[model samples]
Target: MTAVDPRRLPSAFWYLWTAVLINQLGGFVILFLSIYLTQRRGYSVAFAGLVVGIAYGGGGIVGTVLGGAAADRWGRRAVLLTAHLATAVSTVLLGIATGPLAITVAAFGVGAASNVLRPVAAAVIVDVTTPEQRPRAFALQFWAINLGFAVAAIIGSSVPDRHFVTLFVLDAAATLGAGLIIFARVQETRPARVDPAPGRGGGAVRGGGAVRQVLADRTFLVLVALAVLFGLVFMQHNTTMPVSIRQNGLPPATYGWLIALNAALIVGGQLLVPRLARHRDPAHLLAVAVLSMGGGFAVLAVTQQVWGYLLSVLIWTVGEMLHAAIMPTLVGALSPADRRGLYQGVFAQAFPIAALVAPAGGGWVMDHFGAATLWWCCLVLGIAGAAGHLVIGPARRRRLDMLEPSSTTIGVKARGT
Candidate 1:
C-alpha cells in the first residue's frame, strides 16, 4: 500500500481534527493550574504539584475507562459532546472555587470530563479511516493538537494574575464550541454491535467481554506498560520540570518558553517525522523514542544552564512527536472494529495512570532528594521502558502480521459506502 497523505484524509476526520485543535487551543486550565494553586490560591509548591497531579492524572484514569466503554456502547459523537459540555461546566467551577476542597473537587471534575475526549477522538478517526491512512491521520491530529497548544501556551502564560478567571472562562467557551461542532457535524462512527443472544446478558456482559478481550491481548498489554513507563517520564514537563527549573534559579517564564518549545517542535516535526519513519517497524520506532526520552532527561542530570534545558527539551520533544504519531495508529491497527473504542480507552488509561503516579512521586523525590536525582530516575525509567519495548518488539511484529490480513478486510467493511 502507498503512504497516506494528510491532505487526503476523510472530511469527517477534518471536522474531528478541527474540534481537537479548538479544544487544545483553549485548554488553559491544566496548563496554569499549578501556577494558579501556588500563586493565586497560596498553596505551597509541593501541595500545588500534588493538586495538579490528582486533578489530571487521577481524574484522567477514571475518564478514559468510562469514556472508552461509553464510546463503544453509546457512540463516539455522544461521548465527545457530553465530555465537552461537562468539561465546560467543571472548568467554570474550577475557576471560581476558593477553598482547597472546592478547588480539588472542581479540578478533578474538569480532568475527568476533559480526558474523555482523547479516546473518543482517536476512536472516531480509527472508525472512519483505513489502516494505511492511520499514521498520517494520527500525525495530522497530533500536529493540530500542538498547533493549538503552541498558541495556548504563549497566550495563557501571559494572562495576568488578576485575570486568571478569564483563562478558565475562555477554556470553557472553547470546549463548548467544540461540543457544538460535534453536535452539528460529527456522527456516531462506532461500528454497529451485533445483538446478543436472547437471554445473554445485555450491555454489561458485552462491555465486560470487551474489557476482558482488551486485557487478554498480551501485545497490547506490553504496549500499555511501556506507555505508562514513558508517561511517567513524560509527565514531568508539567510537574517536576517547572519546579526544578525554579529551584535552579530560572524564572517560571523560562519554563513557559521551554514548554512552548516543546509544542513548537511537535507542531513542526510531527508531520515530517511520520513521513520519514512511515516505513520503519513501529516497535523499533517506539524503542528509539523511549531512549530519546531517557536521553533528554539524562541531559538534565548534569546541566543547569538555559541551553542545557533547551537541548533536553529538544530531545524529548522529538520522542514525544514520534510517539504521538505512532501510538494511536498502533492501537487502531490492533483493535477489532466493534471494539476500537474500548481498546483505545484501555490504551488511553496508561498515561493518566502514569500521570497519577508521576507528579506525586516526582514531587516527593524532588522534596527529599536533589532535582538531579529525580532526573536520574527519569533516565533510568526511560531506558528501562525502551529495553522492555525492544524485548517485546519481535512478538508485537508477529502479532501485527497475524492481524494485518484481517484488519485490512475490517478496514474495508468499516468504511461503508
Candidate 2:
C-alpha cells in the first residue's frame, strides 16, 4: 500500500464511477418517497418526513462504518456491489408498501443499503488517486453525485401524480443496473499487500490498521467537525429551502428550477474549478467557496424576489462544487491508505448528522421565523465553516508540502495508505 501510478489512477476512476451513476438515478426517485407517503399514501408531512429521515440518518449510521470496514477488510467492489443490490430490492418494495410498518422496514432497508456505498466508493478513489490529482478526482465524484440527483429532480418534478410504486421500481432497477456495471466492468482498486506496522511511513500502513490510526488523529477529528457544520448548511437545499420557496407562492416548478440550476452549475463547473485550483492550495479553494455559500444565503435572506433566489442558487452552486471537489481530496490526503474506508465513512456521516437535524430545524425555522430568517441562519453556519477551514486546511499542508512529485502522486497521507 505504498504507491500507485498516476496515469493508472484515471483508469480506476471508471470503476468507481459505475456505481455512482446508478445510485444517483435512484436518489432522484428516492427524493420523492416522503412526498409519496404524505400526499399519496395518506400520512402527515411530519410523519412522512420522519420516516424518510429514518432511512437516511439510520442507514448512514450503519452503512458508513460498515461499508468502510468492508472496503478495507475485503475490497471496495464487494461492499459497493452488495449495497447497490440491496437498495435496488428495497426501493421496489418500498414503492409497493401499504402499511406504515411495511414502509418503515423498507425505509430501513434502503437506508442501510444506499447510505454505505458512497463512503466505500470514495475510499476507492483515494486508493487509486495521487495527492496532487485528488482535487480532480473528488471533483469528478461531486459531478457524478449531482448528475444523478439532477436527473432524479427532473423525474420527480415531472411525475407528480404517478404512482409512488412506479418510482420505487424505477429506483430499484437503476440501482441494480449500477451494481451490474460495477461488477462487470470495474476492477478492484484496493492497494495490494498492506504492511500492518505502526509509526513511520504512510502513518502506520497496514490493512485495517489505518482505520484506528485515522480515528485517533485529533486534527482529523477537527476537520470532521467542520464537515458536519458544512452539512448543516448544505442540507438546507434539500430540506428547508424548497419549503421556503413554496411559501413564496411558487409552485413545485420553482423548486425544480432551483435545484436544477444548482446541479447544472456543479456538474459543469466541477472539472473546471479543479484545474484552476491546481495552482492554488485547496484550503484557498475551500475558504473561497465557503465564503461564497455564506454570502449567497445572506443575500437570499435580504430578498423575496424570484430572480434573487435564482441568483443565490448560482452562487451557492459554485461553493458547493468547490467544497465537493476539495473535501474528499483533503480527507484522502490526510489518511493512511489502509484506513481510507474508515475515515471516508466517518466523513460520510457528516451529512447524516445534518440531515437528522435539518428537516426538523429548517422546518421549524420556516414556520417560526420565516424563510429569510433561515437563510440568515444558514449564512452564519456557512461563514463559520469557511472560517474553520482557515484553522485546518484541506490537507495536512505541513505534511503534503514535503512529498516529492513523480508520475504517481501517491497520496498516502491524504488516502491514509
Candidate 3:
C-alpha cells in the first residue's frame, strides 16, 4: 500500500494540529488536580476524589454533547475559540480559588471548557481532508497529543511545591496561545446547511437535531458501544493495573516507569500507524487492536514478573496506537458532513464514560473474583468487541462507499469536469 503524505494536509489542519499540541502541553491541571486539592488546598482525600470524579468528570462528559451541538449550530472555529478561552479563564480561577466550593466550581469549569475542544478539532480535520488523507491527519493529531503530554508530564513534575500556582498560570497561557492561533489562522469549516425541496415544508429546525440524528443512527451507536467495551478494558491500565502491581510488591515507581514506557512507545510508534493501516479495512484493524489490548491484560493474569508486566504494556500500547488513529476516521466516515461535531462528540464521550465506570467495575471484580478474573473478562470483552466490529464493519463500509460516489462527482465537477 502506498503511503499518504502527511504534508499534503491543508494549512488549516496544521493550525488545528499546532493548537492541539499547545493545548495538550498546557494540560497540567487534570494531571495534578487531585494532588493539588489534597495537598495544597487543605481538602481531604475523599473530598478531592469527589471533586475530581463528580465535578470534573461529570463536566467533561457533559461538555462533549454541548460542544458538538454548538459546533454544528455556530461553527467549528467559534466553538474551538470559546472552549480554549474559557479553559484559560477557568484554569486561572482554579488556581486562585481559596475555598473548597470555589475550587470545585472552578475545576468543573476547567473540565467542561477544556473538553469542549476534542470533538470540534476532530470535526475540523474531517472538513478539510478527503477520506484518503484522513487516516494520516488523525494520526498526526494523535501523535501531537501524546508528544505534548510526554513533555508536559516531565515539566510538571519538575515544578516546585510552592510554585503550584505557576503551573496554572502556564497552563492558562498555553491555552490562550492556542486560542490565539485558532483565531488568527484557522477558518470555519462546518458544512453549509441545505434547504429542503421546494414542495417540502422548508422549515428550519434547530436544537436537538444532533441528538435525534445520532440516536437514530443504529450502526454508529453499535460502534460507540464497542468503543465503550474497548475503553473499559483499556482504562484498566490506569485504575487496576497499578494496584495489582503494588500487590505484587512492585513499588509505585515501577508503575511509573511502565506507564512511561507506554507513552514512549506511543510517541515513537504512532507515526507508523497510517502506513501500517494503509489499504486495510478499518474494522479489521479495530478488531485486531481490541484483541491486542485484551490479550495484553490477559497476559497480566498469568504472571507477576516485571518482564511480564512490560510485555503487557507493549501489547496494549500497540492496540492504543492503532485504535487512536482509526477510530476518529471511522466516526467521521459514519457521520453526515453537516453534523460531524455532534457525531464526533458522541463518539468522544465513550471513553470518558468508560473511565467513569471502569474503576469501580474492575475494582469490584478484582476484590471479589480476583485480578485474574478481571483479566479473563477483558479477553472475553475484547473478543466480543472485535466480533461486533466485524459484523457492523461491512455495513458501514457499504454506506461510506455509497456516499463516496457523490463526493467524488462533486470533486470532479469542482475541478472542471
Best by lDDT: 1
Of candidate 2, the 10-residue stretch with the lowest lDDT total is 408-417
- What's the lDDT for candidate 2? 0.72
| Segments in model 3 whose C-alpha atoms lie over 4 Å from true places | 1-7, 32-52, 95-104, 160-166, 193-205, 242-256, 366-372, 406-417
Residue 69 lDDT, candidate 2, scale 0-100: 73
Clashes of each: 0, 11, 0
lDDT of 1 at 169: 94
Task: Put the candidates in lDDT order, highest first.
Answer: 1, 3, 2
Q: Which is the better candidate, 1 or 3, if ranked by TM-score?
A: 1
**Number of the predicted model whose TM-score against the real structure is largest:** 1
Ranking by TM-score: 1, 2, 3
RMSD of 2: 3.8
- Candidate 1 least-lDDT 10 residues: 408-417
The lDDT values for all models are 0.81, 0.72, 0.78
**lDDT tens per residue, model 2, 146-192:** 88888888877887565556777777888888888888877787776
RMSD of 3: 5.4
